[model samples]
Target: MRRRFGQSLRVGVAPGALALLKTSRWGGAAPELVGELAFEGGSHPEAIGVALRQLLQGGGCANWPVSIVLADELVRIWQVAPPAGSARLADLEAAAALRFQTLFGEPTGAWKLSAGWDPAQPFLAAALPRNLLALIEQVCAAQRAPIVELVPQFVAGFNQWRAALKAGAWYGLVQQRVLTLGMIDGGAIRAVRATALPEGADLDWLAAHVAREALRLNLAAPARVAVSGHAPAAWSKGATHAPLACHLLGQGQGAGWSDCARLAATGSRP
Candidate 1:
C-alpha cells in the first residue's frame, strides 16, 4: 500500500490487548489502519512482546515511528514531595523512590522510574515494569521503529488538555473501566488516584466516589471534575444531588504528536 499519511503509528497497551492505529497524521490524509490483539492474562513482558510483534506485522507498520500509551492499569503513578531544601536531581530521585516504596511496598530496582522531577515541589512520578519496558524496546529495535513517546494514559491526558480545565475543577481520565483523577489546587497537584470502575457506574457513582476520595484525603471535592477520555456522554446530561459536576473536556491545544507528549522518546538506539 502506498503511504498516504505520514507513517506515524499510535499504540495503546493494556493488560489484555495491544491496539495499533496508523493515524492520518501530520495533517495528511491516509487509509486508516487499526488493529488489535486480545489475549488472556496480564501484560507480561514476553506476552506483550509477542502481541506487539503480531500487531505490527499484521498492520505492516514496521519501520514506522511510534508513540505509545501504557494503560493506567500497567503503570503506578503517584505524587512525591522533595525533602525540605532539596536541590539536586539525586534528591528528587531518592524522594520518588522512597515514596514509591512506601506506597507500593516494593523496592524500585525492578521498576523503571521516571517523573517530572523538581527539587522545589511535589510532582507526579511513574513506574513501568523493567522487563516490560525492555521488551518494548527490543521490539521497537527489531522493527527499526523509533519510539517517539511512551506515557501513561493519565499523564498523557493531563499533559494535553490541562489548559482547557476550569479553574479549581479536578481533572480526570476515564478509559477502559479505569478512572484516574488529579486533585489540583493553585497550579500544584495535591493528589492522584486511579481506581477501578464498577459495571454500569454513572454520574452518581462518580460523584459519590469523588466525594469519598476527598473525604479520605481531607480535600473539598471540587464543584466540577473535568474529564478527558472515553467517559460516557450520558454523564453530561443529568442532574442529581451529586456533590460534584462532570463535563467532558474539549479538544486540546495539542496538534499532531502532542497528543502523547508526556514522556520523552527513549533516546536514539543503535
Candidate 2:
C-alpha cells in the first residue's frame, strides 16, 4: 500500500544544479519555487548530496515526500517494442535489462531499471546507476526526507507538455546539455530520441539536430516547437524552411522549470 502525504517536494536534478519546488495538491495547482542550488564541477553524488542537505536545511522541506527528476546525463532512456503477450513484470524487466546492456555496453545488473508500457506504442524504460540511487537515498534519509519517486527529466517535461502537444505533431526539448525530440500522434508517442549537446554548442546546432532526427524518424515538420532554457528564436532560423513556430515552455508567469517540478510532484508517469 502507498502512504498518503499532505505536502510534496519536487526536485529537478540537473548536471550541476538543483531546482526545488513545493506543492500541496499534486496536479491541482502550480508548484511554488522553494529555491535552486548550484554546485561546482560535474554531477557527482557527493557534491549533489551535500547541496541537497543544505537545501533541505534551509528550505523547510525535510518532512515532505520528495520526487526527483533526473537530468538526461544521469538517466538512460530507451524506447523498445512492447512485449508480445501477457509477459510478467520480471520477464519484461529482464528483457529491458538485456537491451540496455546491448545498447550501452554496461552491465545492467548494477543499474536500477523502471519500465513504462503503453499498449498502443513502444514501451519506454529508464535506467539509473544504483550507486547514484544509494547516494540520494542516504542523503534523503539523513535529512528525514522520504523519496516517493524518481523520474527522467524528459518524462517530467513530457507530462507537463502533454496537454499542449497536438496529434501528429513533433516536439523538441533542449535543456542541460541535452536535446530530446519526439513525435506524438493520437495522444501517444510514436518516436523519440535524446542526444547530448557538445560543449558550447549553439541553438542553431540544436535546431539542425532536431530537424535531422525528425526526418530520420519520418516525421513531418513540427506544427510548433516548444522550448525551454533558451529563447525559441535560437532554434527558429536553423530549423529547415521558414522560421519554425515555437512556444516557449514557460510562456507566462505560472510556467517554467517549475512546471516540470509540478508534474513530478503530481506523480505523472511516462
Candidate 3:
C-alpha cells in the first residue's frame, strides 16, 4: 500500500515575482524542476524549458496539489506561447488535477494560491474560474488552514530553502511579504494578515513597514524577519525588534521551510 504522508514544496520563479507551492500527501519523490515552473523563465522560457525537460527525464511522480502566483504580464505572455506541452496559468487547475490523479490516484487537498509583487502593488487579482475553485476547494479540505497567508515571497523563500537543503547547505531564507500580526500557538503561525508590498522598495523598507503595521494593528512584534531575493544586511538593527535573518536561497534548509509543514498541518483548509 502507498504510504499516507504529506509534503509541501514552494517554488519561487526568476525574472518575475511569483511564489508558488505544491503540498501533497503521497510519498513519491518530488519533481526535480528547480523553483516554481510557472514563470516564462525571465527572457528565456525556452532555455528553462530545456532544463526542465532534462530534469523530468529522470522520471519522478507528479501527484501533488499545486498553487502558483506570478506577475500578470508573465501569464499573458505564456498564454500565447504554443510551445509543445506548455501550460498557461489559466490551465493550472486542470493540470494540477491531472498531475494528482496520474501520481496519487486522487487529488490531495486545497491549494492556497497567493502572489507577491516585485514592487509591492495595491491590488492583486485572483482569477480562478468557478470550476477551478471547486477543484482547489476539494483538495484543500484534507489540509490545514493557512495560519500565515501563503504569499508569493514566503513561497519563494520556501523554494529557495528546499533547493538549498537538497544541495546540502545552511543558509538564511528571505520572504518579502506584508506582515500582519498573527497568533502563534506553540510556535506555529496562525491568524495572520496578508497583503502585497509597495513599488521600488527593498527588504529594509519592508521590515520597517511591517513593524509599523504591527503596531497599528495592535499586534505584537514579529518573532523574527527573514528575507530572500535581496540582502538581509539592509534590515534595521534595533533592540526590541524581531531578529532579522536574510540569505539567498540556494542551499541548506532555512527557518521558514523548517516550520512551514507544521504551519500547513495546523491550518489545513478545504
Best by TM-score: 1
Q: What lDDT tens digits, residue by residue, belong to model 1 across residues 62-167? A: 5688888887778899999889999889989999999999999999999999998878777889999998888998888887778988887778778877777888
Q: Estimate each model's TM-score.
A: 0.84, 0.74, 0.30
lDDT tens digits by residue: candidate 2, 1-270: 122466677787766677777766554555667788877756787887788778777776666788887877788878766567735776677667777888899878778888775543567788887877888888889878899878776777676666776555556666645567666655556666766777655555555665676677776655556654433444544545453555556433234554334333333321
Q: Kindly provide the TM-score of model 1 when superposed on the true structure, using C-alpha atoms.
A: 0.84
Q: Which lDDT tens digits does candidate 3 get at residues 1-270?
A: 121356544333234222333445454443222332333445344543343333222223144333333222222110111223444544544443444345436443433333221121111212222333343333333332222232333333344343333221222223343332222222332223444555644555655655665567465545454433323343434524343332333322222442222222221211
In terms of lDDT, the poorest run of 10 residues in model 1 is: 261-270
lDDT (C-alpha) at residue 136 in model 3: 30
Worst 10-residue stretch by lDDT in candidate 3?
72-81
Number of the top candidate by lDDT?
A: 1
Candidate 2, after superposition: displacement of residue 105 in Å?
Answer: 1.1
- Each candidate: what lDDT? 0.73, 0.66, 0.34
Model 2 spans with C-alpha error above 4 angstroms: 1-7, 24-31, 83-86, 118-120, 185-187, 195-211, 219-222, 228-244, 253-270
